[model samples]
Target: MNPGVHAGTRGTPLTPTGLSRPSVRSAGLLLGLALLAAATALSLSVGTRHIPLDQVWSALVAPSGTESDGIVRELRLPRTLIGIAVGAALGLGGAVMQTLTRNPLADPGLLGVNAGASAAVVTAIGVLGITSFTGYLWFALAGAALAATAVHALGGARSATPVRLALAGTAVNAALFGYVNGLQLGNLNTLDEMRHWSVGTLARRDPALLLTVAPLLVAGALLALALARPLGALALGEDQARALGTDLRRTRVLAVLALTLLCGGATAVCGPIGFVGLMIPHAARAFCGPDPRWLFPFCALYAPVLLLVSDVIGRIVVPPSEIEVGTVTAFLGGLLFVHLVRRRKVARL
Candidate 1:
């Protein structure tokens, strides 16, 4: 065993390098906060118009009806705020999902949350003639909850293992997404409306929309944080966690609920932005080890950094046209996922 690495649950060397110490974990968390701040600043400053940092700050603090102020207050601020919220939700959700499944590669989507949200959104636009974000938000949440609940039932609620849950979720995801695709293909109007949204960009999100979903996301975040200890115990294996008095069924149920709230709200707002939930946990693990106590907070803070930075990149990559943030993350995350698989042995939880 390397001196710098510490054994985690099941004697796995989960901590990389010198991050095993509490002080180091705290420092890493602070660093994540700094990165988030920088990402927020960049999201505000770097856009098609390229407002200076000072001007961005000025616009935020004191709006003077200038073009910059209008752009900052009306446009970038909402986008940035939504980005932060969505990013945090995805990141925290991913971490919890991965921990619950004991699979480092697992993401929130593995539970059918994204697919469920997408199917509902497609239905909203195609069948219900609902085009507004606010109108479809509740439908998205209901769909996600139903899908996850069905997954749990299929997985045998009481006897559900990680593998069983994953398989059930995959089945549900396939079915729902297939339905979504067919509906979209059959209706050009629905397809046109969904084209931009399905690609997952944070552009033109209303602040009021964020406010509407804020409570749900915040509740989900709190629930995820609360599950850290139980998840950590579960990572040690079911028998061990049970021996330690952890109620596996209750924990799993709550975890699913938390994920539904987190991923559901995020998908409702941003239309299934990929890779933040998939990638941020892995990055946070390298710095905070496998302990959900540390990893969750790190993911919560730094995930927004990845999301906001990607949004900024999207804005500048194609002049005025700009790539969608989801497109950028998918491209980057695909490469990173490949690298993670090929470069090192996948960590076992």
Candidate 2:
């Protein structure tokens, strides 16, 4: 049986079997929100020096000139906020990619978006002598936009087939990675700065840094949310969507623009964190079926859960010297991906 085919031909919304119950969806959303809150609290409290919940509350409510105040206000607070934003961006980006390509395994990292941004940053550092991340941010966004345009062009945007897009992304990703590696190898200065930024982490981020990329991330997120219905309409196939008056060209352009902003902004702030996007969207599908509208909300809530939990785990797993959040998420997400594959739960729309 063709997994993509179904009995309905009216372009009506389709939910995965046994998962369309409204009560179930409501419960799932509530549970996801609760878990997100818990994770946010955990992120604020648990670290190298674990702060008690009461102290955490006090630090949040009113700083009292204590050591906990400094740690809470200065360090963990910004890191937690950034983690939430980055995680949400990755999750939404992943959802968008999977929906756009109708591919179960699509992600920004795998699609060369992250590599393109990273390469641009490296180039800025090496050739342009851009010393600060603020300078790197503009270059990263441009690189991501260019890479996305290239991918669509190579993939035959007029047709916009899944296999062609994936192949083009793979080829572009490899080429960009080669350039990044070449730059790193040739310049010791580039290597030193690039190595640290390349390992995705939420540490040492200032509240001011969050302000830098917030507008882009917010814009991308709002665009994604607004396009939820059109994305769902896409599941009915291109011909059906066109018959229903969906503009395929406009949709593709908008989706690409939204993805560039989200992926580019996140990478600019926290490096190229992988798997969050790939893992969360599939999980969202399992919870709320394949409706992009439903899936995105869950993705927004649960992705931060995964990211914050992974960061907390990273803090304690190795004690004094903490492992990066990216490493922890990669380890966990890889295991989840393997498990999902084993169970045959991952499928294209």
Candidate 3:
């Protein structure tokens, strides 16, 4: 089914809309891909030195007399690719979490997954002297898992509720942030070393980090995709879902774990990126129609495109010293969040 003409609520068609479903979805996907391609070109062509678009394209595809090709292929390609991956993870995870928890505001970072990962990395660095990004990937994953567990524990029971889940998430976020700060305090060296990593930056990432982290993030996203039907069933309320053979507990566990892998690995590699999760889902909804399957994949693509473009913009706007990617994303994500809260359009999700 082309999805551009009809709306599917939980693996079932809910209604037929005015527009052609296939055409609408196709247009959205086409637009996303076009933007991504343009963003990739812009990222390659617009750097410190004014490399002509033709030269950049030629160099990127096949090396030439000068080092331009090598620079484009070697340095910028990896960074741009990693941005796409990380952005996808954040966006996909955000879409999944929002659907899973049935709350428009839910995001991996907002619900403290990134904070948990950050805290874990801090613990590792402070106590174990673990500085290698590859080595600490597990630390981040474990921290995210623990933090996720804490949130669920506080909100998972029948006595517990989704609103409580969010509150628990917020409390955990604050407490973990404070603890990380406390550990950083009274030790200038620790603070100095962790400052860049803690501030949600893509400062200096290992090319290998993407390779190491991609599998986990991709797997988590796949699992989240699998939960789409059950999640939509649960969305009508747990009782309705149970009547529909949806296992609410299992779905929640799986979704949270997916979030752990995506947010944790991304945070470990490039610090805690925020708003990609919170904002991308809303964007995804405009096309995907609240179905996680469509929303999930689209978010993955759009997230990276948005983030990389933001990073590229940062590079171009400020001469030699580039603005951090997280800084640019946060400013935009924060603004959207405020509007989302007030507009009632975004809040319905």
Candidate 4:
């Protein structure tokens, strides 16, 4: 057996032309980028009014102040940009999370991060009467950090297994979301404000909100990328990872911090879009063979493709009315979840 080659579930070396070969992985990355570009174009062009690609390009380059220009520039462009940023954050966060936990089912939401953010945002709206995205952003970050910390403590940080952490996260997720529901049910204003947000649409978000959250997303992305090598080492097993000079404590700490920033910022701006994190990493692993270096970038590119395509579909699926992107993803992710549960080979990390 070659020390350089990682083995898949059946002990097959994961270096075939279709798998972990550097050339093939690089080509896959390019293909992902191409797909993302097409998704972005479709997102801009396939909205309620169905603007043409020429007009979309013109709106970007030279705006004539037409309704099409308003739709393209004011609405779709910001939505597309937010989708890209949030999708990349969720994708990279999910890859890091699954690697850190050594769990195939790990995602940002699995650890209660999204629930914490939602609960905090609801608190801000209902209790504090804070209506600004910036305010929600701060509360969301705080809640995510607190929830992750609680999960770490409850899971027995020094001796936590993947199962223990997952159980702890599940407990915390249920509790926080229950609290969120209670607040929404008690306050009509909160419920009204959270109606669309809870469903997770990319519509009606202010462009300024993107500017506010950009730094957090970039920082989280950089941190997640930097953890790739250490996380890959950790994936080999804790004893082996320690032998290879991986700092388990520091790695876990940074990974959690990165998850908080990425998940919190995304939930803040877009209101907790699901399944992008869960599905994209698995899809990337199919092509990249679980190497975090390749897997992270591939997830980043392809997650937005899934998200934007879902948003476009949500727009056109019904007549003038549209479904939320979250609803679309939830339906799709539910199918994928069923398939994963039935297929043992794909479900193991």
Residue pairs in candidate 1 whose N, alpha carbon or C atoms collide under 3 angstroms: none
Quote the lDDT for 182 in model 4.
95
Candidates 2 and 4 compared: the better one by TM-score is 2
Question: Candidate 3: where are CA atoms >4 Å away?
Answer: 1-18, 157-160, 336-349
Model 4 residue runs over 4 Å out of place are 1-20, 336-349
Give the alpha carbon lDDT tens digit for every residue of 261-321 in model 1.
9999998888889888888887777667899998999999988998898999999989988
- Candidate 4 residue-wise lDDT, 30-129, digit = tens: 8998999999999999977989999999999999999999999888999999999988888888888899899877889877888888888899999999
- Best-to-worst TM-score order: 1, 2, 4, 3
Give, for candidate 1, the lowest lDDT window spanning 10 residues: 11-20
lDDT of 2: 0.85
Superposition error at 206 for model 4 (Å)? 0.8
Error of 1 at 155 (Å): 0.7
lDDT of each: 0.89, 0.85, 0.78, 0.85
Whichever of 1 and 2 has more lDDT, that candidate is: 1
Q: In model 3, how large is the Cα lDDT of residue 214?
A: 84
Candidate 4, residue 225: how far the Cα is off, in Å: 0.7
Pick the TM-score winner: 1
In model 1, the Cα lDDT at residue 46 comes to 93
What value of lDDT does candidate 3 attain over all alpha carbons?
0.78
